[model samples]
Target chain A: MAGENALNFQMIEAAAGRLAGHVRETPLLNSPFIDAIAGRRVWVKAECLQHTGSFKFRGGWSAVSALEGAGGVLAYSSGNHAQGVAAAARAHGREAVIVMPEDAPAVKIANTRAYGAEVVLYDRATGDREAIGAELAEARGLTLIRPYDEPLVIAGQGTCGLEIARQAAEAGVTGGDVIVCCGGGGLTSGIALALERTAPGFRVRPAEPEGFDDVARSLASGMIQKNNALGGSICDAIVTPQPGELTFPIMQRLCGPGVAVSDEEALRAVAQAFLRLKIVVEPGGAVALASALFQGDAIEGEDVVVVVSGGNVDAGVFAEAIRTYGDAA
Target chain B: MAGENALNFQMIEAAAGRLAGHVRETPLLNSPFIDAIAGRRVWVKAECLQHTGSFKFRGGWSAVSALEGAGGVLAYSSGNHAQGVAAAARAHGREAVIVMPEDAPAVKIANTRAYGAEVVLYDRATGDREAIGAELAEARGLTLIRPYDEPLVIAGQGTCGLEIARQAAEAGVTGGDVIVCCGGGGLTSGIALALERTAPGFRVRPAEPEGFDDVARSLASGMIQKNNALGGSICDAIVTPQPGELTFPIMQRLCGPGVAVSDEEALRAVAQAFLRLKIVVEPGGAVALASALFQGDAIEGEDVVVVVSGGNVDAGVFAEAIRTYGDAA
Candidate 1:
């Protein structure tokens, strides 16, 4: 609770080196259509295309691979990180125990199991998953991996920003805004730190779902904030009650006051992505693009980088996303 | 009507250079899970992520850019070519008039209109779209662009193979099998020509939907063949009655015996793609992947490159594909 995000540029570079053969160097995509919608040039780092269908794989792999003990790893996540840990652990022939919420998508739970992890579901509304995870890790002598607060986890996610730095250099850009979907500030803080060292002129703007905008509220008030509710959003991939202790301070230092997007706007972004970008994006993943398209006046930068964070959602949800808002095409 | 696929590798390289900054360098993806299922390394060139959500964009841009008189362009397509022509013509500030089947996906018609093309729908069961297109082209003084037989079109589609060659070199693979979805063999023939010149060790194998396996039948016999029926398969995008006049020759010379997948297998591949690859692949575009997964004994390659040619489908169709086959994840 006391320490800064402490991840430096060198650590992130080392993580990149560590993850060279293990993780995907996800592509950067741009469309004139997306640019027109935002009224400016916008680039999208398509982490939705990453393994485990999210950028969470980077952190999960970084943490799992660095585990020196033979006991393997234990973690808690709604879905994306669950699959990430399971997949990374599988790659290394290590064991993974994922404590997931019962309300998480069936596809997510199934994917985590298919990746060869032992999964335990808990009632997210009534049970404390973190406490359950700690008990299991202690009982089994397994190393517990926090989703965003862990130093190695933060370092791992920063590798994405490092790749962005190199990719942006290739694209002849020294500066811009990186709009990242936020839950607990892990990816945003890590990316901001990475940019501060390597890409100097780039800034981070966290995008959040409307009611669960704790990070955005925290950024504006200069204090930790909490959402009044948690489970109503369609953006299930990212719906934290508050920012992580380790991530909040760094976000305070590096990111602007974030923007929040409505569920309707996120669905619209999902449809636009499917229509024009030809990719599948979940509600949480589309929030950044939603902010970029709908909150243009509030954000800064002529050239913006919107991170499409994941593409894992239920069939009915995706259908609604496409059928309801597809006419926007 | 009886010429060969006269596109040389140099022509493809020229098209690539010509279309630089205009066309996207689509990413190549591979999944270990997919590899395990196929019992080999299957590299997927994600042309679904390409502009207009298909490889058709390449040919459209290539032919449109080479237009000398600039009377605008006219084409007859089921759907993809309509979008390709619309997108390319819009980019070049030229008019595009597309004769599409009236039964094509509503999304396809919407996308074509979004790109500013004038669409004329014809009944596939009763009318001759080619004749309608030709008549309109002559009447409106528009240049008629054939789907696959046009030399420039074939050369343009070959750019995908060109990029694959460079990407394969970077990945240190000298040769493999290139599995391509075939309607009239535009993309398949173009890639065959490109690979023949650049990576001679790689063999081409065309994949088609079961009921519409004209190309596969044509490859088996020593002459052009036609499907007994048209427009029954779920793969509405690739339902050509027969192989193209120009494309068939190149495919016959360069490719091995082609494989065909049932509509069920194609749906499974689409679901698998969504679950594992986190990409949206339409039914026709998924045939190559379906063949690779289900007909592995027929294909010849230690390393396989499956061209996921397109990702344009109705929301309901995609939702059904996901709900039905996504359980494999």
Candidate 2:
């Protein structure tokens, strides 16, 4: 499948202008405990605090607001992107249809519906959500918003990198690795492109879960790769089968070497964030943080900036993480 | 003992200037679900994300920075204040000794010590902490930084209020109740003084946990009132014996009627914060949020603001809160 055209900083600036009042500028947090564990200065960009509990909202708002005479929008996701697109569509006074598997968490479905999105549930084993989404969009005149392999979406995610560039400078961090939890590489590539122009001294590193380190393997081999297995890891948020067609090229051009951490490390990072940083972070969202703290030898420099991309985990999972790793973390 | 002299907004402004680089300007958050529950617009000031995981950092920095060639500092707190003062003191390259009860949580003690402070453990059943703190301060020639009764501390906490006024106005919220989790009334009175000058349209309201509703009772009686029992509720962070002498007068003159909520309500608020806002809120820190969501009738106007003052909680407590109230919230 083909992807959208390349993005530039100007597009990100335009997206920023469009998203000024609509998107939140999430805080950058650090704890001495986190720094001590990482053996360096560790700053966490709390994107989990962003609207819809993820950085996906930036892309969602950017795409929805840029629409011309929009009828509505359609998206297929069982996680952050669904709520993000729904909320953005509702805020723009346009309808949104979200296609999700029937087996997805009930809370996620309810949250998406709460944002005024029309949720179309399909059987994950027998039905294709993309097909359902496309049919619904065609019938309703709804624009299909791809999760990551889209230009405006990448530009929206780039706004986060812009903030990091400025915030790191403000915090006296002129040079560091900006670690991002990678799924389809939208956030990772967008940040790389943003930092390429704004903070060239800083580099972007894509961090993935251990068994799903396709981005890491792809970066090392200088070619895109795919994950063999998909559904076992607890870090489901960043477990895409492969990198995005649009984002991979940008990442290859701009990002540093990729990093990966175990699911246990991700869960431990979730516990530490809850204990020391006083924020809710899901296993997938904590992967970047895990790489920053546990895989410190893989990264260079005295300072590291990690983006916690989202925080929408089931209560049982969160409970298990905290109970199992809270003390040790 | 008599309290320190009354404070003014200028004092808070001076504290802000001193704390420009030392303290974090915490974010203000809101969720549509929260607003739906309240039947109005509700914004939460996430002081839990502040340095030391509480707004106490502001006052700590203010007190520590205002010192003139100080020898060192001494403080008494079993929770947030201990870590806050320790961190502020460490940032200033000054020695600090924190006096805590032996029965206090080991994690709190370890966190305080981790901030480079000397820990002095006293027997809660037999030892007079005040006498021990005074003696140690006198012997070591260290200045005693009071938790809330001191003028500089109140001025420090008021910095949070200054930010709130500016942020609320930016959010198009001109008039509303600014609810606070009250303990010694330091944070409540400090915000009242600040908003009195910067945002007169906004009113401060103290929210206390049930059975520890000294501030609410005191506000009703127009005098200082003490809680019948001190150590029972899960909301231990804001469970003060009584309102401060310095703070009561300010709150009486500037604050609106007080509000109170039960422990279950506070725990539920914590769960809701974790789910919707993706921020951690301990039971004590969540009372104001509980009041805003569950006791909306006591508040006025379409827009209401609540401060989640701190997020230093035990894993067991937090896990229990999420397990019991996560789905319902």
- Candidate with the greatest lDDT versus the true structure: 2
Pairs in steric clash, model 1: none
Per-candidate TM-score against the hidden true structure: 0.91, 0.98
Q: Give lDDT tens digits, candidate 2, residues B117-190.
A: 99999999999999999999989999999899988999899999999999999999978999999999999999
Off by over 4 Å in 2: A1-5, B1-6
For model 1, give the interface RMSD.
2.0
Model 2, residue B61: distance off in Å is 0.6
What digit string (tens of lDDT, one per residue) describes model 1 on residues A184-265?
8889988888988988899888999998999999999999999999789998778998998989988998887799999999
Q: What is the C-alpha lDDT of each candidate?
A: 0.86, 0.92
Q: Residues B1-329, candidate 1: write the lDDT tens digits.
A: 32562467788888888788778788787777788888988888899988888999999999999889768899887688888878999999999998888987676777788789998999988999878988898899998888888988998999999998888777677787789999999999999999998888888899999878889888888799999998689987888889988888888889988888999999999987887787889999999999888889987768888999998877778878887777654
Q: What's the lDDT of the predicted structure labeled candidate 2?
A: 0.92
Strongest candidate by DockQ: 2
Candidate that scores best on TM-score: 2
Q: Which ten residues in a row have the lowest lDDT in candidate 2 chain B?
A: B1-10
